[model samples]
Target chain A: MLDQKAHKPHERLAAHLKDDLSQVDEMIRARMASEHAPRIPEVTAHLVDAGGKRLRPMLTLASARLCGYEGGHHIHLATAVEFIHTATLLHDDVVDESGQRRGRPTANLLWDNKSSVLVGDYLFARSFQLMTEADSLRVLQVLSNASATITEGEVLQLTAAQDLGTTEDTYFKVVRGKTAALFAAATEVGGILAGVSEDRIKALHDYGDALGIAFQVVDDLLDFWGGDATGKNIGDDFRERKLTLPIIKAIARGDDEERAFWKRTLEKNDQRDGDLERALEIMTAHGALDDTRAAALDWAARAKACLDALPEDPIRDMLSDIADYVVARLN
Target chain B: MLDQKAHKPHERLAAHLKDDLSQVDEMIRARMASEHAPRIPEVTAHLVDAGGKRLRPMLTLASARLCGYEGGHHIHLATAVEFIHTATLLHDDVVDESGQRRGRPTANLLWDNKSSVLVGDYLFARSFQLMTEADSLRVLQVLSNASATITEGEVLQLTAAQDLGTTEDTYFKVVRGKTAALFAAATEVGGILAGVSEDRIKALHDYGDALGIAFQVVDDLLDFWGGDATGKNIGDDFRERKLTLPIIKAIARGDDEERAFWKRTLEKNDQRDGDLERALEIMTAHGALDDTRAAALDWAARAKACLDALPEDPIRDMLSDIADYVVARLN
Candidate 1:
């Protein structure tokens, strides 16, 4: 029953933003087309058509409207947010050597890494093009800074992937870069385009940042014990040796033998039979899963608190509910 | 002797822009550094320090200065141009699976494809960030559009690389996308920053466009017949199955036997020991090499003619001489 509730808020939010969401969708379709390079549209279509929730762009639109943005540039900014998100997904799949994303074959898997990488670059350039069309220098600065942060987060992730010495602070920095930066930008730009007060803009950014962290934390926790509703095989992160929050927490408290097990399984990438079960057991022994869930819930609560700066409206209520729903999966 | 003279004009232009070029270099060095991700500078420094001519950025500087504009923002725009160029080279090396660039092991070969793709992305984002710092909406539009065109050009080049039906017109389209788009943007933005007349802006764009076409055509010609002074082995393009202007021309005029040869060597990517030599023989037989050289000269002439819109000045004289030097490699 709780799991069923998790899907309701985003759907309702999408419906609330239906007209603007549709505009964003149309903008995405029009912008993704390539007049000369057919492969760009083909590769982009495969991912765009894959049933992503379009949650990020929806957040941008909702934030803009919540702050009383009347102009049409919100659509452009929303579409730009989606493009940045999609471009990162394309490159992330290649970097991870992933085969499936959103329960479909990845762009890199279907076409090639070269196409995925180049097309990702194209979408990023297109995102810049879209952002400029918004006619706001401040918006450009925020999004460009977010883009740099995202890339820095990715490079940090690559270097920090299998190392056992990765600290919790470093983990948060990586998450902030890879996941939360764009979310913050997505919402912050919405407030910016509306010419909202600086305090309100900061509040929107904090909301998106906390929501993104909570989302990623829950996603990581689900990787170990989450059911199929997460659309990922349990323990996938363990198998890949990614040092997520739970694993890092577990390793910090792990005994010598447990550390050796982690080194063998993750650092060395020599995963064996029963490794997944052992990882789960060790994580449980250290209470890592519960702590990670608690952390996600705390972030979700923080995200909800940031909405107090905004005027009461249906869109604002939806954002608050979306935060609650992000951590509800932990139940 | 002529080839040696070809290298002198660029050096002279660099000298002319020494103060601005030094500032641009400092900006590049500063922007490329990353506090979180150390690997970014490592990969970027490998290419940035590889002694590239910095011709694109120089055009930006020269155009602005020649238009009698005095502003500090030209350095930012010029640096942005170089960042765009470097980012493309990094991704291009990955897409081409090149082991060497600028006579050293490429970033992809030295590190891995993952680093190359991600860092290329970092630079693109950095370029966007740099463009925004210049304080001009029109500058943002020109550079963003150029960024999109550059990526599209790369994607077009990917799809069109080995196909035999790639015509002269298609080759120009691909070249324009891959090479001229940025060049045109670089010079166009310079004029815009100077707030020059519309005619001068168009002239700057046309000059960059024709100069880039001439540069690429001559580079393609040199790929087939260049001596060691060009720092490449002749026939490398043929060995790689690239359909440059000469190969496209030869394919267009070839008889049935020659068409079959192209089909086997290019489309099929099947090559024997004598294939490069034989390919050269066929191109000669069809006079494709001569025609390609003539085309390069014509573009160079067009590039020179565009400069008539600018005032008579030393910078204009240097630009005209650079065009002549581009095609001098054919001699």
Candidate 2:
């Protein structure tokens, strides 16, 4: 079954960069340990061991290798990327009050909100320490800026959560900050560490940015797609009163009755039974899901097109395949 | 009144570094502003404008100036230090469930925990961006390590809260992490950016660490000293079940009855009307407050002594005065 999964683009990239990935893992384990705070490791181990796809770090590894870089700093960079992702997830769980993540009880749920917040902070510091070791001022700038962007996006999402007036522009801005910023930084720093040209580096950034936007759109669509495919309960977004792309589109095209339903369920958060079903119906009636899927496909195509600027290599092809794979679920 | 306040050592340092301090303020206001997320600045302004003395940034500026260094990077470093301090305060309020800080309602209270957490994260990222602009990898390493230490200390404090078994060693470790790490980093990074000798940098680190320990010990002592001098209600730490030095000392020396009282009040968190009085009486009987005061003075003296290694500048004198002023309240 594991070998069969290897046919996936990200998995193929992982197979190609097996040694570097292991080194990244080793560095993550080594750095996450704290002599004073045993709780830090216990909380982090629960999250890291749950085995998310490690998609962000894999992007960094693939990008660097695709540019023909042969040095250990890429490992540090990759590990740093993963650490940032983990840190954000830990904090996000607390912010979202999420009970489960990656199919396991979240750190916030298992330990407490205090542990999640502080441990998330610790991971962020660790990520910076790793990035500093890579000795690239430019990489530090990119990652730190991305960090700021991610947090800003999260804050925007929080403020926009139940507002029926949330625009698609605001939705895109939030997605760019919370998701694409890190993804773009992850790949851009790889090209940067490899001493690639400005054009190629920009191309890598564009690819990652588009891929991340696509990934998040697909995720939001999956939340309303009514399936067990994403390992999440369908309508979780509606239950949480989140303002994602589909809901935003539906609101834009909604009738007065539909608008009243959204205001009662989302804006006012007086959700009743069958509210999720009603939301899905309204979204489908407005063709919001179809438009959202079209947006995801558009981003995926843009991501694949950006890869054309990179040198022809197996890693590049895998990256292109990864872009396609991100939206493949929608098909 | 302002001039009278200026006689305070930290105020004296601020007066001395007026130009640079203004520049730090300017940088802080500039960087804290988010183009997309208006809430980020709104939450940050509530905390930043509350005006908590800005001691950490003053340390960074004082260290650099005392080294006779001529550079603009110190402003960035000082701003970064302030940002880091602000970030921690935001997160700390959430973890402590604090309603007020610096005699003002905390950001977490004014907004929410989610806002505080995400905005705190934004400030941290902003701090890193500021640090990278200073362009010294060694400085980054010291500051990032301090960041890790600070978070670890906070987590340890959380795990150790209300536990009767928390040792003095554990107490010191927690204090070192949550308080001294940032202090040490703030000062050490100044020296590092100034291109000072390793020996002088070590001295700066020691000065900041000792000063921070003294500051925290004094704050904790003020909590039980039964006065409004600290702008906090007496026995707040007791109500929160925080095992500070005085309580840790009292617990170690308590008789069976006293031990049971502590276990019931602290460990079990069962308290009645006279519990605070009883707790204070037990601490007084055991000379815990006296001993804790002595500990603060000792650390203050050590902080002052570390400054002797630097050149005899007015800034150095101000630094020594700051150390002495930290513990002078105990008298």
Candidate 3:
């Protein structure tokens, strides 16, 4: 369904989550307005107005609804989570000195690092404000823990950027910190806000966590293979020396010469025209891509398994579909 | 009492906030630990281990306790607030390209902007976690609002740097954003946690806001007239072309030639040897320093007045003394 691509993945999610998404957007626009600085809106609009999957917030809404949350606060919490996500992006652009995000000039590149950094801070503050509105201590704890995890993920990515020896364990930790923690927090907070049972909450948390990991794995996969839809270069991850699952698997299967090539490119960041193609060939021959696809599918299955414990509802069905959608990206 | 050699203002507040201070320290240490990235711990330790005033956390603790809070989470909330403060400092040093803070090498200078930015993100995440521990959406709202205010204040300061026309109104707005908002949040969260009446909560917030304004104004005044014990260079504000209350007031009093001279030194940043002295002369001649001190004292009085409506306790006395202490640095 996501592959039909007459509409975008995020747009599809937004359509299913239309009412919830509209509510979230209005809330975000209202909150982003600041009496103190005019420049704040300018910087925030660059990212907030930019089209994103809204995957994080949707995970939040879907999780809460699946758990039978009837309260209105979950929307606020979802927006809060999205704000944190956007704030991190602003800072990430500044730190990475990236020229593009989703094929657009990053706020840092368009404005300046100083604006990016400070405005990112502003959004973070706004997020905290939104999260604070929930009034639930458990919700606060879940979201905050997710935030810390996200930062740890970013820090891990920072040093892992050029390092070749970065193991799969470290990469997993990074994925958990950067991507999955928020997913866990977003969904976990949903259950907490709903005041659902701990067992079901755990199930939802696992679902979100697994889905986040699976989604990120696919994202890494697409960073190397997403030429048509995402416009990502095949060697994007290679250029960054990202040390994704496929690369790690490829190295495990490599001979000494192949290993040396991997070492020179990843460690030294030395690249040639054919290096990306060579790496892809090695990965294909070693079945690394197959393994990665399998792993993503496994996570998708795990996310679905989490629903076995949640209430049977329309929201639950969509969540299961989302799990499948995450894996389908690799196909 | 504030001017006495043995009884410093901070010392009084420290004594008043002894219990809360210990709690804040414990919380800070506990939160700064990270399992995955050892670098996070190392970088966080550089600042958390460094003995600063613990003033921000103290504000949080005191604000809560003074409002009749008997719970434990205020300590966590206070630490979260302080972490936000420290994270901003880490980022600020990078943007300012500053070297020393409180006589220690800044994180950016000691490590790098990469580490600084990433670690700052880590702390920010950690803080969100801590605030969430408070579990009150109201507490989160106060803390987040303060965080946004702080960011706005910092940005305003950045953009306003070297712009000599930045008015007293703008100066206060900037200081309010950067410094007072956190103080108000610290206090406001305290009231929220205590379940105190909204009126008293507003009072605590006002107390914090006015006290913070007073404290920062005193800080600006001390930067020009304060001795070595003040720990900042006299006229350092002028050298940096920072538009402080003194400079803002001085510009209002300057004639055409003086305005041109002030512009050259401040707006153009073409200062020479004795320019600081001339700037100080302008500040003194127009009673800018005197006016700033008077304004600070007025705010301190207002801060103290806010407490009059509260129950009588040593902490209350201590809070008032803290206000007096902010303006006492000139002694």
DockQ of the candidate models in sequence: 0.69, 0.77, 0.57
Tens-digit lDDT track of model 1 for B48-92? 999589999999999999999898999999999999999998888
On a 0 to 100 scale, what is the lDDT of residue B58 in model 1?
A: 98
> What's the TM-score of every candidate structure?
0.96, 0.96, 0.89
Q: Which candidate is the best by TM-score?
A: 2
Question: Native-contact fraction for each model?
Answer: 0.72, 0.86, 0.70
TM-score of chain B of each: 0.93, 0.95, 0.91
Candidate 3 lDDT, tens digit per residue, B252-317? Answer: 988998899987987776878888888888778999989988999999999999997777877788
Please give the RMSD of candidate 1 to the true structure.
Answer: 3.5
lDDT ranking of the models: 2, 1, 3
Best by lDDT: 2
Ranking by TM-score: 2, 1, 3
Clashing residue pairs, candidate 3? A132-B137, A135-B137, A137-B135, A140-B132
lDDT of 1: 0.89
Whichever of 1 and 3 has more lDDT, that candidate is 1
Q: Over the stretch A9-43, how does candidate 2's per-residue lDDT look in tens digits?
A: 88888888888888988998999999988888899
lDDT of each: 0.89, 0.91, 0.80
Off by over 4 Å in 2: A1-5, B1-5, B98-111
Badly placed stretches (over 4 Å) of model 1 are A1-7, B1-7, B98-111
Error of 1 at A131 (Å): 1.3
